[model samples]
Target: MPVKITLAQAMGTCFGVQDAIDMALDPIYRGKLTVVGQLVHNPQVTERLLANGVRIVERDQIDSITTEAVMITAHGASDSTKADLQKRGFTVYDATCPLVIRLHKLARFLEREGWFPVIVGKADHVEVKGVVGNLKASAVVYHERDLEQLRGHERLGVVSQTTNRLDKVNTILDAMRKLPWVREVRFIDTVCQPVKERQAAIATLLEADIDLGIVVGGRNSANTAKLREVIADRGIAAFHVERPEEVEPRWFVTRRHVGITAGTSTPQDVIEAVYQRVREIVAQPAAADHA
Candidate 1:
């Protein structure tokens, strides 16, 4: 009467999330630490850090904090944000993933050279906001229809939010190339490898014999939302939950196989908890049927 639960091979935290946590826990800045944003978009991680005495501060409140050093989240920030913190006499420990920093540098370089930068990302995401806020002449393009709005720009430089879907970026680029007055279009693929790998792994899961999908991460996490969106696109029932308790028993009633995938920011323990809960639900039916 025992039930079986299988987790995705590549589920849990990515390198960027690991790096951010490591940087935050570095010995030098042990006492009186403040993070500019949610460290990596996992509630459990944030809560753990909070219990450890790390303070999470909003962007506007960083200037008001009295900490010796403030950490930036893995989702990279603008140069201006760092400059502001430095102006306030706080040593800034940048926890941004190297890949995201690379994209920020590319955006600045392209902008300085007179190329209008086009960022393919959600406008409200903290990472995209930081990226766009740094640029002097850049625009955030979320959908393919936004392409028509770029009627006057001659030279276009394209970069994507580090966690965006590669296929979406490619589709947008292909559409931009068809614009009549657009002279030259150059795209720097900025999608993080971890995100791409996670997405691809989920795609493979969709093709498998799974009845439902469970995605775990912070509610405000853009990448996590995208993961849910990707799974939902397959027309299968998918639930994005932060913790195991959020899993609904009804979702598993008739399911023979359940696929579990977590975002880059999701912790290993949370994934295991989800699996354990699913197994618990499955076991009930098996027990009754056997009885």
Candidate 2:
């Protein structure tokens, strides 16, 4: 029998990521540009940019930048951070996704409304850090257990990382809504549309007869990790891999149906490569013997 490989309809690079790369590699800023952080979460994308002459600098190393132009990655930054970079004389090119800008605005609005902004995401994630920094969040939580650190507030607002899986964020939001002392729980939806679609696509695939799933993206990609986490939590076998070479024959030996999902930062070509690789692996004569 032939192996069936299913690719998520919404998988791979988002508009924001392509725009960032375009601006970074544009002739206007070529060789003279430096991104304050990784242009996107995918290492392949960043490596391509770096090989093409884009320079990367950590946020703390802004003052050390010798370039005349700096690009703010798709992940975004606080208004204050942008101002500080401009103050130092670098021509700042903001490649922040418009959606992320809107998300930030929402967080700020929640804060101004006297709602304690509770971020549902990894505290160390670049997107989460920017959101928290912009909103001046006192604390952020990814799970119900982390809520113990949050004090009882009359009104609480929750926002999630743009690339986070909605199922995970919804789980956290559900827990927040059930909190006893929280009179009003404002669950703001900051998860990006593409991310949500990809996650939903994954869920649809997981519901099928697939023996396991493959999530393609950088290991450092927060959204990819969350998708993998959610899929595994559903009792499905899933692997988050960055490249085609990472695929193992063992993962598909007994599996006839394979589900493929990619993070927003993952490039389309990478997804294709993984898809083809899986098909090739399962075509081996002995592949289904273990099934």
Candidate 3:
């Protein structure tokens, strides 16, 4: 019997990620540019860029960079950081996603208007760090327990990491409204549309008769991990893999209907590669024996 494969309606890299990758690979700067961070969360994309002679360095290692120019990742950077780079005499190339830029602007605008800025995202995430950097006062909260930091403040201004789960963002928002000390609350929705659509698509894909899900993206990718979490939340078996070689044949031996989804930073070609691998796996006789 031929196993059936279904793909989520909305999956794979968003325009912002794609644009950043294009800029990094552009022939004009391929050899001269050094990206300040992983251009995107996907290792495959990173490897491809490296193969094309692009240089990537960690934020802390920027001091070691000898390149005359540097590109910011899609996650973005604080204005101060950009200014400092320019002050150091390096030509700066910004690849900040427009949505992330909007979040930074909204947070600053809120602070200017007398609201205490509160960002909803993982405190350590590069994107969140960019938004929180240089702010006079800000609190990063990903759970209810973190809300305690927001107390003693009368007014709060909130924005979220573009890749944060909408449900989590809403839960935090609702809880903030109930805090007795918070006299005034202002919120600007910062979750990007691509994330929202992928989330909604996964929910729709779960309604299908698939016995398992394959989530493709880099292991460190926050959005990719969230896709796997969503599948697990629904009690569906899932395999989250970063490469086609990681898709084991054993996963499909007993699964006739498999659903495939990918994180927003995952490339289209990567998704297709995984799909083709799945087809090849299911087509082999005694597929489980290859596992």
Question: What TM-score does each of the candidates earn?
Answer: 0.92, 0.93, 0.95
Clash totals in order: 0, 0, 0
- By summed lDDT, the worst window of 10 consecutive residues in model 1 runs over 1-10
Distance from true position, residue 27, model 1, in Å? 5.3
Model 3 agreement with the true structure over 1-291: per-residue lDDT tens digits? 678888999999999999999999999986899999889999999998999889999989989889899999999998888998899889999999998898999999999999999999999999999989958899999999999999899899999999988888899999999999988889999999999999998988888867899999999999999988888887889989999999988777667788999998999999999999988888784865566
Judge candidate 3 at residue 56 and give its lDDT.
Answer: 92
Q: Which residue pairs come into collision in candidate 2?
A: none
TM-score of candidate 3 against the unseen true structure: 0.95
Once superposed on the true structure, which residue ranges of model 3 sit more than 4 Å away at CA?
289-291
Report the lDDT tens digits of candidate 1 across residue range 159-203: 999989898899989888889999999898889888888888887
For residue 27, give model 2's deviation from the true position in Å. Answer: 2.7
Model 2: residues with Cα > 4 Å off, grouped in runs: 287-291
